[model samples]
Target: MQRVTKERCLEIISRFEPTKEGREKGHLGIDGFTAYLLSEECDIFDEEHKEVCQDMTQSFTHYFISTSHNTYLLEDQLKGPSSVDGYISALKKGCRCLELDCWDGPNDEPIIYHGHTLTSKISFQAVIEAINEHAFSKSEYVLYITNQNLIFLLLNIEE
Candidate 1:
């Protein structure tokens, strides 16, 4: 792996700095940083379309990658039913990116569910299995699975 040095970091910051003084001083303003973050070099869609040959400079809409949120929910994210079939359905619908929420479950097994809601939990293993079976069914695009890791605190009070 290539290690990032201070000089390389400064170079990257300067590339995104809007003001000449900030660039010379290796300072990244909020505007410059936000622009850098929203740029194609750091965009997931651009990363997935690395093989495509086109004009490098374009708006975000130029990338037409489809994505899904709460992929395991059949209805509302707050109180919907979660199932492995959701993953299958989303993949079949040409969703190249799927979002999932994972939390600690019984017996140390991780499960997928919408926390603090009525959404039912589905086995993380089952979701993975479903994805493995249907990820490439609709398109040859690389599938990006984004999972939100949750941490909880249990409180005990004596009245």
Candidate 2:
């Protein structure tokens, strides 16, 4: 992202792109964009972007949350299955903002699922439990659980 040139773009895409097809086709996709954005070469002057930071005691607002839109979907929006795996993966990766699209489920329980046509459903309790297990495994930063179209579940944060 420093300089734009045919050679530089190709080198960046080829090395950072997630999929072989994208790397082969020489196009920058979302995953590749994220990789490049978080890569060291993205901001050579700023050492905070590196994997291991010298200081992590700064305020949450000072750093990017490393978040995503729909955290419970493993695949595309329409056909993906929602599960706690998504939450676990994000939490382990130090993602701070996680979204839970809760809806009234059978027997008075809340559930998380895609907002698309797919029927992927997982208990909201399961998602919360997973978060509790993994939220502090990576870092002690605050985690924001954004609930869409339903009651929110903000956990007890001790930091």
Candidate 3:
């Protein structure tokens, strides 16, 4: 049992050949084993994201990456402030959903943001564009409920 990096996870997935003799029966991305090692060897998953006194369990398949700091990262790159790069990075990281805040804007523009004070500005359409454009390797899931029309747009948008 060992920790699983994304590359290592991919490697393990690659070895799951159904044609193999004894290896023909189940999901083998090594999640439970990896979690056991982390819990026993190092106190890694010992925090709130772990479990206690029970058979080991591998968690959900999806990875949740936060987009809060994305704005700052993009801002850092610009040496000022920007939301563009962060929005792009979140999509690249395969974010299943984004928690955003929006306001009723002039000319029916659904302005997306996190707070009353605008640190960076992005419209609902911009977010959709980024997600749709990155659809090739993306897992395509809910964009969450922040803006209803945007969510509706996502639902109706065909592949």
Candidate 4:
């Protein structure tokens, strides 16, 4: 059998990271390993991406990808990923796929809330700072992944 090398391992990881399942918490650590990749390149050791992906991956294993019916009720009403909760809930209830909208935030933080609600009280930097502090706690329910260009606007009304 061919021995797995770091480059070969990275090649394997690159394929998995794009899937919703690969991004899940339980699988994140174990799944990123390739047959012969170095510890540094493994997703388990990448501090920055791990920070953002850890929490969001919490329930990924149990949850199946699905769509929400309520989205049609608010299709024209809400904008961006803010509708994820409704869709996530619907996915839990049995929806198969979902559509999410996204918008840019100050400093490109990608606020996932709908519309311009965050524009008044906080800036993207402030939100990132706050998330840095609180995101890992049990009280919060967001997974913080960095996007190169597009910003996310999530709405966590439950909080």
Between candidates 1 and 3, the lDDT winner: 1
After superposition, which runs of candidate 2 have C-alpha atoms over 4 Å from their true positions? Answer: 1-59, 149-159
Query: For residues 20-118, what per-residue lDDT tens digits would candidate 3 score against the true structure?
Result: 432334344355445434544445445654333433244323444333333323443333444545656765665545545566766999766545454
TM of each candidate vs. truth = 0.54, 0.59, 0.41, 0.24
lDDT of 1 at 77: 72
lDDT tens per residue, model 1, 61-142: 5777688888788889778898888889888988877877888999999999988899999999988788877877776656
- Model 3 pairs in collision: none
Q: Write the per-residue lDDT of candidate 4 for residues 1-159, one digit (tens) a residue.
A: 268786654556555554566544323344444422444544355566434344455565554333332232233444322333343344333333333333565675554334443322223443344444433343233342334344343333555
Which regions of candidate 3 fall more than 4 Å away from where they truly are?
A: 1-82, 140-159
Off by over 4 Å in 4: 1-66, 69-84, 113-159
Candidate 2 on 1-159: residue-level lDDT in tens? 345789888998999999999999999999899989887677656565436564678865677667757888888788877778988998888787788888888999988887556859999898889988888787665677777654343454656
lDDT score for candidate 2 against the true structure? 0.79
Backbone clash count, each prediction separately: 0, 0, 0, 17
> What local lDDT does model 3 show for residue 81?
45
Error of 4 at 149 (Å): 16
